[model samples]
Target chain A: MALPGIASFLVTIGTLACIWGLLALGLNVHYGYTGLLNFGHVAFFAAGAYASAVLTMPPPEQVSQANYVIGLDLPMPLGFPVSLAVAALAGGLLALLIGSTSVRLGSHYLAIATFALAGIFEDVLVNETWLTNGTFGMNSVPKPMRETLGAGGWQVAYLAFSALCLLGVYLLLDRLIDAPFGRLLRGVRESEDAARMLGKDTNLVKLKSFAIGGAIAGFAGGLYAHFLGSVVTEQFVAGVTFVVWAAILLGGVASSSGAIVGAFLLIAFQQSTRFILTIYGWIQSVLPEPLSGVLPAIFAPLPDHPSFVPSVRFIVIGCLFVLVIRYRPEGLFGDPNEVTVMGEEE
Target chain B: MASALSQFLQAVAFGLVEASVISVGAVGLTLSYGVTRFINFAYGEFLAYGAFLAFFLSGAGAGVVGLPVAAVVAVLLVGALGVAVSRVFFRPISDRGALPLLITSIGVAFILRYLLIAGASAEARQLPVPLMRPVEVAGVGLTPLELGVVAVSVVTMLAIHLLLQRTMLGKTMRATSGNRSLAEVAGIDTDAVIRKTWFISAAAGGLAGILYGVLFAPFRPTFGFGYLIVVFAATLLGGIGRPYGAMLGAVLIGLMISLGSTYLSASYDQAYAFIALVGVLLLRPEGIRGGEF
Candidate 1:
């Protein structure tokens, strides 16, 4: 319940919002524009984190753990940019591997395949310790210019850098979505048969969007790794995928601005909820029920149990997902037509 | 070579046990999907509920009378839960389509999982059955409990087959699942059929959960949820919406998973089924069972 000061606060929530905003935008490109459901978008996010971490991390021999492989010991200058490029590449290639076969199956089947692929990806990361270090995860990542900027200053600088990157991505996506390519994506989404009839390489177009979205996800992942200073296999749970999906649905699936708004809104919702929980926790601690213990016991099984808070958190988000789907399929910022993701329901 | 062959055979034997669990679930999922036309991801939650119901029943000292009494009550209870979910969350919002329905299922899954965490300790629980001495067959050690699990699953499958094929309600279910509009025009209540389908499917899933609890030993709320990918693959592998396809596909997938772990690294056993599913979809997007296309 110790409140992080202003600088730490912005970096904590702000950097995360930016990271997730990038992911939401990546998902928006496919689910939003193309109507392709890339259900396992988290795979690319993991890919970016691993790629960046491996490039910058020292070889296993250099450290006590030879548990994972492929560290290059590159300087921040070389490591950071290369990591981005690798993230983009890994994302695209993975998308290609998953997309080429499953995209043909259409949205429903593709959703299942991508979800499974992400699960399989997690298993690989968890079990194949030689590669992903088997769940212990990679740690002690050197933040860019940490020596010069100092710890707190580096965090602030990273937050600024993240904001700038997000802005660049937003502008870039806006232009892309407004262009002819974007229109083509829309066509592919609404009615692939019609697009195919029109002589568009419909499959090819879908594949491109899938790969591009994945690359963006990778880019986001790379940024996340640098900011986080560690990469854990647990980071890519399917819940994270749903959160991004919620973001796009909440913000506005169709627009870049909407994706940004949705990401911020989702994070704010999460943070505010946590703050409320913290306040309740303080209240419970301060006031004894009948004697004070009664209230805490009534409210939470063991007030201090870590799972208690997360359980409440999950309940809130689960309810939110249901309500959002029910009331605002188009989201707060989206155009009415942008409600196409769940449009078929009605 | 001899060791490898025996290991393979041993895997097949174990796979049968795994397949029995998956088949019951697959049948339920396919039957529900047939009319509902949405992937009921929360179907896995039914398994957890069923397992926990029995777990609690035994905890309440239903030990000797457990299998018949406690399990039946659990199945019926979960069936009712399915009906309630169908009426409450799904029916009102289902007008949307597959994506919303799918998302809703995920929401329901979260709710069930968190609820389980809140209600039951997150730690694993035993089914309260005593360990039996292992029975050896062809150099493979099998337990009496394992055989009983398979026997129970077979009886359930046969019962379902009779319901689907012989009984009037079963015939009605078939007609509705095949073509809802046609069935409705013929004065069959598609709504009633859907309700029944949801009930039967959920009950079947609960039974599968109990077997999984007994056979797998020491399970938690997330037990069935973890196997969802394999179950989905099984359902789709046999083709979606086909009445019998789920059972057949589940058997194949169960074999693949068990044998894969035996032969390949156990770490990627789950991936094998997923890979098989992708392969099947690529070759036959309509599923292994041809329908509607």
Candidate 2:
């Protein structure tokens, strides 16, 4: 049932873009809304996925063999809810711990601490073979309604589910941002000392923001895990964190729609590059050997190699970050007047 | 019991060797932070570039010219990179706030890493330098390579200390770090001091990278990325901008990692480092040796 033409590919990319957009929105709550620089948001995502997967596991032995622990053999409908809850719980708790310890530190210090903590979690995932099965990862996790509904139906159902989740999250965030609590958060984001002097408990506000942001990230992670049908440590690496950060930056940090917009643009750009390179390669095949070799590397090879793509992605994404920071720190959707604190503007 | 004791002693010695390399790198980080007032995410890339340069040079038969000469070349190359980066990236954002500078540094780091990947093969390359054979002391084995690293690091630190205390350039650097405006007003060439700081810091980082490559034998393009966090933890623990504090922090980190690996699973070694860092931040946010936050 292979769909022909670029339309199918475009649809596939659009779907992923939506997911990434949702993830980025979660990140916005931390970086854009509250002005917290979290470098370990991916950990929450991983935790969500793993928790969901483990919650749906059959037995101890089965989970062990699968290198995951989803403890129950329930249907995806039930499992999905549990996964989200588990992720939020875990993420919130971890955020609480992290916030309690380092939220009082400056923004930069908090960022580094989270970054280091992310690395430690990754290390744990890789080394704790008993828990995570080292690096081989878990597979064969059932998708929602895959057994009852056909592939197409499952896809449609999942897409709808994801949309609902995204909508719910966005609305909740919108309401939160409009409320007095959101004002307090924005207040702290603008000037922590001033907020403190105004009798606001800045630390408590930061901790709450961190916890909520982490919970949102965890919820997205659960969705991603279920979609992939398997979870790996690679998915939660610092690189993914950076990618989400990039998306938030591109969309407009404080703008809700910016998160979705940035994710769509980034994913579309990435996929389009692949398509363009493939076409270039086809054209190069017709040319003489000497000319073919001289063509840009993108046109010369299809880059079927996984490592090549990731390395190139890093370079490109890194450049994008630099460009955005230098020329468009406001991001595409961000308020021009809302300057980033922590030394960039002032 | 005796075997465990021996193992403990062996771990300490190995940890010391590891700490020496880390101290070298952390000092570079501390120095840059001390003067510039921003964490250079590209600091790890300096180490990476230096090691890669040495790997290429040694492969080109420069080792026959002697290890010291090859090391000097590597250091010089990395120092040049640091100077260039500071001039091109840091100078433009010198007056800008911290986050922008941090982001710019990240960009610099990203560019260096990917450029290395593009230029060199993605595969991990073994450095051409031969590891000195291991020698035993008190029923515990130690390698000449490790011993050499410790000696060189100590010498470098001592020289840096003296240069800071006695040399005009070092004094100027110190003065600038202490008060850039006052130093400028006092007829000090702050830019020259910054350049010198970048040169020494990057050279030290490069030397550390080379020593690590020599000891570990091989590394991938992203090898230094993993160590960046650990280095930051050390820097934080040692006091953000104090060189000696970095050394002490490195030692503490090294000991924790080595001992943790021995007692618990090796997988938790890095986690132990993170936990220790968190503890330090909670208990002593100013670090063991206080510095300007």
Best by DockQ: 1
Best-fitting candidate, scored by lDDT? 1
C-alpha RMSD over true interface residues, each candidate: 1.9, 2.5
- Tell me how far the alpha carbon of residue A309 in candidate 1 is from the true structure, in angstroms, after superposition: 2.0
Tell me how candidate 1 scores on lDDT.
0.82
- Please, what are the lDDT tens digits per residue for candidate 2 over residues B1-293? 99989999988887888888888888888888878988788888888887888877765444554566777898999999899988877787677688877867777787778777866757787776565667997878887877888999899888888887899987888888889999999999898889889999888888888877877767877777777877887888998888778889999988888888888878686777788787777788678987542
**Candidate 2 lDDT, tens digit per residue, A1-346?**
3345664565567666767777788788888878887878887777667666666655557554554443566666776687678877777777777677778878778778888777777887777655565687766556766778665556666767777888788898999999999989889998998999999999899999988987777777777777778777777788778788788777877888888898888888777777655777698789988777666764455444445655676688778777787778888988866655534654
Best by TM-score: 1
The C-alpha RMSD of each candidate to the native structure, in angstroms, is 2.6, 2.8
- Candidate 2 local Cα displacement, residue B7, angstroms: 2.0
Residue B114, model 2, lDDT: 79
lDDT of 1 by residue, B130-175 (tens): 7898798777767888888889888988898899888999888888
For candidate 2, report its TM-score. 0.93
